[model samples]
Target chain A: MIRSVFFVSDGTGITAETLGHTLLTQFEQVSFQQMSLPFVNTDDKVEWAVQRINRAAESDGVKPLVFSTLIDSQLRTHLVKCNGVVFDFFETFTGAMEKELGVTAQRVAGRSHGMGNVRAYSERIDALHYAIQNDDGATTRDYPMADVVVMGVSRAGKTPTCMYLALTYGVRAANYPLADDDFERGSLPAVLEPYRHKLFGLTVDPERLHQIRKERRRDSRYASMEQCLMEVRAVERLFKRERIPFFNITQRSIEEISAQLMQQAGLTRRI
Target chain B: MIRSVFFVSDGTGITAETLGHTLLTQFEQVSFQQMSLPFVNTDDKVEWAVQRINRAAESDGVKPLVFSTLIDSQLRTHLVKCNGVVFDFFETFTGAMEKELGVTAQRVAGRSHGMGNVRAYSERIDALHYAIQNDDGATTRDYPMADVVVMGVSRAGKTPTCMYLALTYGVRAANYPLADDDFERGSLPAVLEPYRHKLFGLTVDPERLHQIRKERRRDSRYASMEQCLMEVRAVERLFKRERIPFFNITQRSIEEISAQLMQQAGLTRRI
Candidate 1:
């Protein structure tokens, strides 16, 4: 039987996986199960979660370990009634934060630990970049289901994120490149017409583009600052003309980009 | 330019990338040139790290985001000399532990974090299983790198992991079925012999195996508890005799296994 049950905040199952994973490495003898309860702040949901935690603890030969981060008292009491060891962040941080912050967490942040959500956003962005690098643009005809298709000059992080959506969140992501000819012609590729509902453009600062391009080629025509700026301007106009949502990669990290894209595309975690 | 430097640690650079990518998501105006120094805990590498960090902070007009688990001092001091923000766990934990545990971390643990050569162990076990699952055993030639290979018996959590790794890691992780015949044969498939290094395996509890397989194939030879127990016994013996160091997948969550396999394969943050 597994020895521990780890409950994390809503949408942070992956973060719990990463942290719980490290903790599990230290204690090799025990098994762990992840219980992801999103939006546990509400009174009704917290009560339901408490019942589940109690059942998991009492159902077996030995009471299991409950390692949790439940912020609500409704959930905390249910946890207290359970017949096992309960290691909770709420227990650890509640009194401390109450003393230090001068106001309770409820008065400040709603069931905090959005840090995990931020981490998941990073994982999705990593996947997006991975997807972009792997997109063989020649054959990317008619793959559906990306809430948004991120188009940018080469080396802009796009495909990794699409794959992140597919790999981490089961979102189908397809990427198209803005080739030199397409840039010169000032247009997206022909095949992107049908999926225009999900098209977005990414452009970076010309100087950074120059540096990134310099890594692959030394002073090539495409890597030239003038050429990069020209392309960036063209791409921006295309995004404006085509009315596709677009963002500058210069001032934003992938997480910021992914969140904005998710918001623009009306996407959220399935959980 | 930013004022802080950040360091994230993984047993290897994988954890570094995971967190580094996440931490960068916070600000839109922030731009930090991300650098990852792999295998930096050794003594000689410290000065070189310090030089680079200082150079970045001063010359690049950007605070360095150094994602490292530099357990060794010579390397960390390199950054210590620089005037930037340095946030690192290896520094945090080891420094805390040195004061709290009353012993130097180097004395407490030989190294800070690693799946402690688990990649090597996983690969060794996985190699034989990969050999067993090959359908093209009839062919007579040098084995091509496996298009797909997986290790783990039924209900062993190998299938989902294999699929995830294949789909996400872009690794074709083909899992082998470990029935009595495969075990009794006393050797992996001939096709796998050529690609032995590419084999991988997963192991789990017999009762769990029965419960999982029961749902899919009831009243069959494969689903029988007795059969599951016998096959597990035989395959384990075979693994022992073959000198394959295996992991007990029964207790491990999928992310841990996938992370371990990716680390074992040296495929962290490749894109």
Candidate 2:
């Protein structure tokens, strides 16, 4: 069955969408047609959202599900009047939380994802730039400043992991791609020797690596099974010998990899 | 006063942290010492988390607040015995949702951020690579494949915005850095001429641009206030003259920018 669902928020709506997606994943039997209505802080926008929700309800022949993270109670009041089953996240929890914490909520809008702290925002941008500049071992001079350095063979999911770490946690992450030189030499790169403490490795299943590389360069030796197996074996051996922590990214998402890297590497989130 | 808060989950803990952070932001008067406990799927991990939460409650002289997205009910039963105010997200909403949808929740662990769908995961990675390859006008050969092309002067927040869009939504967002060449030409770049409908622009206040550029190249003409003003004005005029839709990202976060871009560009999330 297909149900209409909405993630409504006064801010970026990211939190609402994320939590709602998590909750909906438990119901694999039902398919959801999802929409996000963001920046719904005004009464007019609330009315507009109500119209959309009511229309969805009418067309779908069932009440649409509205997962709301709207912090403004007045706006949320307007939202609940719609012909939908509302799961008001903030309203559900904030009342109990206020009594427990013995403090009143500020009820301000857009504070979650807005540029509320300029310094933290700038640091996040700086971390992203660092990841870009230091990608693929472009420069090791700044390795001392890196919170973590990720190493993996080509297509082993290094770049995306580093970028996710930097953007999500404000952690300065640099990545290096291990190639024939490192595998043939049978040792850690000379430049990475000094920063072994911050080093983390990633390896993928050989077949998976081959599949990934084949997409980039079809019918090439680089995408051959022999090449993929050899590189993965060498990288895993190096990681074990050097006592560097590593993860197998063959079955993991970038979010999972980044989070595990932070915990295993003992790297604190800068933001 | 300082309060301890924990975001606990059976998966990456990202959704729990996101929703918990959003709720915490409403209480500006309280300072939160926050921690995330991820991948707590087993009974052993549940016990470990209980010990940690209890310790925090004992040390802080106040009961900690636990925001949990644990999908497994038995694990959550053990968690609530800790000396903390537990806010179980799934427990709070799932029963109601089950009744509304007339289906039982699967109660599967780690489905939210797991690699449940391989095609979706690969598409997200491909989108990230597309953003990296097409960044800063590196190549325009693949412009036709992009959902949107973001343009802005240096430090006006194009690269990061594009990267965020790609990573978060699987949207192929390419960015071109507007430079002296585009301004001198007094028109869109020749490569971008055919893709006017797919174009979006980003602009920042000249003073903000000066500050951002100054951090990168101090005491250089590139960072000069005069240069910043000239570039911003020229690019904005080009946007106005060409009727290219644009946003001033001086006050918006990357999440906000990406969401607004998706709305304005009519880009649908692929994942």
Candidate 3:
């Protein structure tokens, strides 16, 4: 059965959507038509959101499921009156937390993903710039500042992984792309030798690498199956020889790869 | 007093962390030392996590808040025995959802942020690559494929915003850095004229722009306050003159900026 799911929030609604998605994924038999109502901070927007939820319920012939992070009690009151089964995230946990902590919640909105902490937010931006500056072996001078230096062959998913790490975790991740020169040398790049302790490798299946490369540069030797196989074997051997921790990115999403990298490398998130 | 909090999950723990952070933000009076225990899919890991939680509880002389997204019921049974207040996210709502939908959940882990949907994962990667390739006016040819083209002065926070949109929402965002040529011409670049509807401007405070530019290139004309002021004024004027929607990004985080952009531009998230 298909159900309409709404992630309602006073702020970006990201937390609601993320948590709702996690919960919804368990029901494999059901399909969900999801919508987000972000920036519903005021009474008018909340009223509009209520109407929208009720409309969805009427159209679907079932009470829509609402996963909410709305902080205002008045807004929550308005939301619950709608014809949907509302799971108010803050309301569900805040009362218990208040009793446990012997204090009342501020109940303000936009604190989670807003610019509440200037230093933390700026650190994320700085990490992103650092990643871009040091991306794909752009420079070796900044390796000392990097929390992790990801090494992989071209199109092995180093750049996106580094970007994700920086943007999400405030991690200073620099990536080095292994090319023909490194393959010919048959050793870790000389510049990366000093940062060996911080190096992590990503290896993709040869077939997948070939497919990715072909999409970028077709009919070239770099995209050929023979080249891809040789590169993958060489890189994997190098990772083993050097005892650097590595993982296969053949079938992993960026989030999975980043989480594994942070855990395996023991890198703490700056944010 | 400080309290310890744990976001424990069988998978990446990201959802747990995100939702936990949102909830914790409401209790401004309490200080939390938060930790994430991901990949606790096995009994041994769950036991270890329980011990860790118990340790924190003992050390703090208070029950820690444990926000858990663990899927295994047996592991959850083990966790509830720990010396912490466990908020089992899946357990809290899944029963009601099952009853409402008249179906049993698959109780799977790693589906939310996994490569279970290859096409969705590839689309995210493709969007990331698109953002990079089309960044800083790298090429104007791909404007047709761009969901939104962000225009801003150098260091006006375009690149990171576009990157965030692509990574978080799978939106194909391209950024164009407004440099001497565009300012000199006093108009939108001729190439961008046809795609005016897709354009969004970002303006930053001159003082903030000076600070940002000075960090990258110290004591240069581009980093001077006068230059910053002039460029910001010109950009703002251009945005008004052309009626291009713009927002001040002086103090907004990437999440806030991207959310605002998506809402203002009427763009739907592909993810």
Best by the TM-score measure: 2
Instruction: Give a tens-digit lDDT track for model 1, residues B1-271.
Output: 4434444332334445444444343332353455554445545445566666777667766556565554445555664665545555345434432342233444221122332443442342233233323322323242465544554565565545654554333454555655556776887755556556666666778887787678668999889999888878877877676655466555454555665566454443211
- Top-lDDT structure, candidate number: 2
Local distance difference test scores for all models: 0.53, 0.92, 0.90
Cα DockQ of the candidate 2 complex: 0.89
Candidate 3 scores a chain A TM-score of 0.96
In the range B1-271, model 2's lDDT, one tens digit per residue, is: 6899999998888989998999999988999999999989899999999999999998999999999998878999999999999998999999899999999999999998888699899889999999999998999999999999999998888989988988889999999899998899998888899999999999999999999899889999999999999999999999999999998988899899988889887888999
lDDT of 2 by residue, A62-109 (tens): 999899999877898899999999999998999999999999999999
Model 3 chain A: ten consecutive residues of lowest lDDT: A22-31
Worst ten-residue run, lDDT, model 2 chain A? A261-270
Comparing 2 with 3 on lDDT, the higher-scoring candidate is: 2
Measured with C-alpha atoms, the lDDT of residue B46 in candidate 1 is 56
For candidate 1, lDDT tens digit of each residue in A96-204?
4234223344422221223235345334433433344335463554356345566877766564445435444434456677867876677667778877887777777
Tens-place lDDT digits, model 3, residues B87-136: 88889888988888889989988888888677777778899989988988
Better of 1 and 3 by TM-score: 3
TM-score of chain A of 1: 0.53
